[model samples]
Target: MSIYEKIGGEAAVDAAVDIFYRKVLADDRINEFFDTVDMESQHTKQKAFLTMAFGGPNSYTGKDMREAHKNMKLTEDHFNAVAENLVATLQDLNVGQEEIDAIIAVCLTVKDDVLNV
Candidate 1:
């Protein structure tokens, strides 16, 4: 099975996105970046992106990571905050460490792009 399947596929990815965003929005450190954003649309985009990233069958047609985040002047702290939320959300849903590690690794691959470094 693909890692997506192993990590519970569509349903799990959807739930993790939902939970992860809640944490992100609630966080004062990162909440400012989303003040004027459309969350529902962002949610949809995130779901598709993560599904594809995790070896699932989905086409992510959103802006590329660098372009998407280029104007944000994002820092490592912002990235870490977002990643922490993701990890916590997955852990809350009982995803295994191995799977979580894989997820984190995949997320890390885009760090430079996200930070525009």
Candidate 2:
């Protein structure tokens, strides 16, 4: 089974995304990066991306992560902050430690794309 299926599928992903974004948006440190986007669309795209990234059926045709984040001048510090928020969100949701590790592994796999600094 795909990682997505293994982890309770769409409902799980949706929950993760919701909690993750809530932390992200409320974070004064990172909110500016998202100030320009329409949050509804951002949420939709995030879910789609996570769905595909975890081997779900959906196709994430979104822009390449590096290019998508290039304009933001993302640095390692920003990426770590986001990762921290994601990890905390997962913990708050009571997701399994293994699942949390898996998510972090996946995020680490994409770090090169999200952090050029």
Candidate 3:
């Protein structure tokens, strides 16, 4: 089964996105990047992105990571901050470490693109 299904599919993704965004918004290190963002849209995009990333369903039609973040001037610190928030969000939701690791592994695949490296 895909990690998405193993982790409870849509409901899990929804909860994780909500909690993750709250954490990201509260994080001083990365919150500045989202100051002008439309969070509702962000949330929707995130859900679709994660769902696809987790091998659930592919409804993600947003820009590729490199293109999407090319203008953001994101640094390693910013990336790390987001990763930390993701970890914390999963932990808060009682997701198992192995699954969290799997999820993070999926995220890591986009790191270079996200960092525009």
- Candidate 2 achieves a global lDDT of 0.78
Which of 1 and 2 is the better model by TM-score?
1
- Taking all chains together, each candidate's TM-score versus the true structure is 0.90, 0.84, 0.91
Better of 1 and 2 by lDDT: 1
- TM-score, prediction 3: 0.91
lDDT over C-alpha atoms for residue 81 of model 3 = 95
Tens digits of per-residue lDDT for model 3 on 1-117?
A: 888999899998888888888899999999988899898898887777667666688744334777888878899899989989989998999989998899888888788888888
Writing each residue's lDDT as its tens digit, candidate 2 over 38-105 gives 99999987787667655678644324777777767887888888888877877887777887787778
Best to worst by TM-score, what's the order? 3, 1, 2
lDDT of 1 by residue, 4-76 (tens): 9998888878877888788988999999999998988988877876786677896443347888887898989
lDDT scores of the candidates, listed in order: 0.83, 0.78, 0.84
Model 3 error, position 55 (Å):
2.8
Clash pairs (backbone) in predicted model 1 = none
